[model samples]
Target: MLPVAAQQNLPVATAQTQNIKRIPLQRFEVPGTAYETVIGIAEIGPNVSIGRHTHPGPESGYVIEGGFELLVEGEPPRMLKAGESYKISPHTIHDAKTGADGAKVIATYVVEKGQPLAAAVK
Candidate 1:
């Protein structure tokens, strides 16, 4: 395990740092069919409606700059604010939209090797 000091000094990694480009949500996906973690900063648009999708594995995220409303299948949508964190389990259906002023969220996705980061579902 990394020492507490080392962990504290570590910087947050983003999708760009992982070599993934900032594509539109509609075009979001792991390029080249290679499954690997891609951490990125996302600016959640206000009142944005994300189509239904499923994560191939787990997706962990935190609100960094703004607030949002998150909805996971079988649960009611909930509001999340800055500094809040949540995790989407493997194969879980979910979607999210920004709050009134929009939000910036840092997301880290742990996907299965060779699987797409998100698979569109209905």
Candidate 2:
């Protein structure tokens, strides 16, 4: 489980209406390695746009409710609805916006030990 401070430090969409609720589920450290896998669920508000950001490692998520518009650098923007899933490569700058009905997703990340999960991008 991530500490409260760490969870609070996670970035959220810029809009006041936008917010991210991260429910840390599990974490596993790789033996003899500096990598750790973290799992969590994220709830995004309706019509919210999570600001552009990059992760310290790869991330994957499955939409559990509603839909989202996802844009990753160098790739065409795409829409993912409930039951759909997406993967983001390490350090890939990306952004997401919830659809009219908002969205919820279960996300898992394989990240470096002692590194912040995400960093905002300009």
Candidate 2, residues 1-122, lDDT tens digits: the string is 12233564455644542366667688889789999888888777788888788888998999999999999999999999999999999999998988779888988888889889888788
At residue 62, what lDDT does model 1 achieve?
A: 83
| Cα RMSD for candidates in order | 11.5, 2.5
The TM-score of predicted model 1 comes to 0.68
Which candidate tops lDDT?
2
Cα lDDT of model 2 overall?
A: 0.80
Best by TM-score: 2
- TM per candidate comes to 0.68, 0.88
Misplaced by over 4 Å in model 2 are 1-5, 13-18
Model 2 clashing-pair count = 0
Relative to the true structure, candidate 2 reaches a TM of 0.88
